[model samples]
Target: MRWTAFLCRLAVGGIFVYACLDKIQHPQAFAVDIHNYRLVPWALLHPWAHYLPVLEATAGLALVLGVARRGAALVLGGLTVVFIVAIAMALLRGLDISCGCFDTDGGHGVGLDLLLRDLVLLLACLPPLLVRDSGPALEQLWRGRP
Candidate 1:
């Protein structure tokens, strides 16, 4: 169980790190991408686009390192839920846009693909929250460690 949790953290955290790096490497392009989403109001878009990558990278690093792991996981998980809601709202409104999530360049538009990807990732976010509190009991049962 511990190993599984570790692997899950690594997977989720690694993707977040990659996402942040992608945005940081191209904040201007990323800003354009965020604008394309039409999700953020025009006025708020610039600040969000500029700052989100930093948050994602910092939180992701913390999750991967097990440093303030619970807090990091909580924030990351909450963000994932927000993404899910945004995607769902986009689809509901019939607005075509790019997910801009780990996007390839700035060409792609948000679609069922992005929606499904986020949905799957949301599943990954759950185990950490669900099992984190109960982990010690399982560890003791397995006699893995103190």
Candidate 2:
């Protein structure tokens, strides 16, 4: 169970970190991607673009490093839900747009496959959130555990 949680943390955290990298580097491009979703208000688009990636990166690093793992899991899980909603809304509205998951530009289009992937990632957030002790984490080392 502990090992499972640890692995889940690594997978979820690593994914978020990877997903945010391009966005952090190119906020303008990310804002365009967010614009394609048509969900965020025009007034809030730029601020969302500027901060969302940083938030993802911060939570992701916390999870990966085993500091505040549960908190990070909660945050990432919430973000995944938002992603799912955005993708679903886009599909329902018949708008074709890149997911902006891993890349801010020229990424894969939003579809059932992407939705399913986010669902799976959402599920993956559970273990670390539920399990109290994830094995071999930095938290354990910090507390002087072997």
Candidate 3:
């Protein structure tokens, strides 16, 4: 169970890290991607686009490093839910928009496939939250003896 939890942290954390890199590098394109989602109003779009990647990357780093693991799990889990809802809504409305998830500007289209992946990832986010200890954390080391 400990190894499992650790793997989950790595996988979930890795995903967020991978997802944010492109967005951070191409924020303008990410902004455009967010715009296509149409979830945010014009005024809020730029800020959301700019800040979201930072948030994702931070949470990812925390998870991967096992620092504040549970909190990071919770945050990433919330993000997964939001992504699921947004992708589902986009598909339902026939919006034909890109998911802008892992790739903000590589033209990754929103579809059932992406929705399924996120749904699975959301499930992945759960065990870490429910399990005690949540694997080895940097917090553990900090409290240990030299």
Candidate 4:
């Protein structure tokens, strides 16, 4: 279970860091992708696009490094929840927008597929939060020394 949590952290954190870095490399295109979603108001879109990657990268790094691991996982789990909601809303509204998740090369877009994938990732993250204290090394859930 500890190993599972670690692997999950690695998978999710690496993807987040890579995705954020990819967007950081192409802010203009990412901003355009955000614009296409039409969820962010025009005034907020630019600022969000500019700053979101930094937060994502920071959180991702924190998760991957196991620095404040529980806190980082909680934050990222919350973010995944928000992302799921936003993606669901976009898909239901039939909005045509790039998913802008991992693949920033060009062919990214939001749809049922993206939502399902994010949902799976989100579910994958839940066990680390749910089944408390079984893992020997997790101080947050366990009662003993780390």
lDDT of 1 at 59: 77
Ranking by TM-score: 2, 3, 4, 1
Give the C-alpha miss distance for residue 76 in model 3, angstroms. 0.3
Estimate, for each residue in 1-146, the C-alpha lDDT of model 2 and write its tens digit.
98988899999999999989999999999999999999999999999998999999999999999888899999999999999999999999999899998897689999999999999999999999998887676777667653
Write model 4 residue lDDT over 62-143, tens digit each, in one string: 7776566666667778878878888888888988777887645666677787778888878766655554432433344454
RMSD of each: 4.7, 1.5, 2.0, 3.4
Candidate 1 lDDT, tens digit per residue, 13-79?
Answer: 7889988887887877888877765778988887888788888898788777666566777888888
Colliding pairs, model 1? 97-110, 98-110
Q: Best by lDDT, which number?
A: 2
Output the lDDT of residue 49, model 1.
83
Candidate 3's C-alpha runs over 4 A off are 144-146
TM-score per candidate, chains pooled: 0.80, 0.95, 0.93, 0.82
Q: Which ten residues in a row have the lowest lDDT in candidate 1?
A: 133-142
Model 3 C-alpha lDDT per residue in residues 50-95, reported as the tens digit of each score: 8899999999999988887889999999999988888888888899
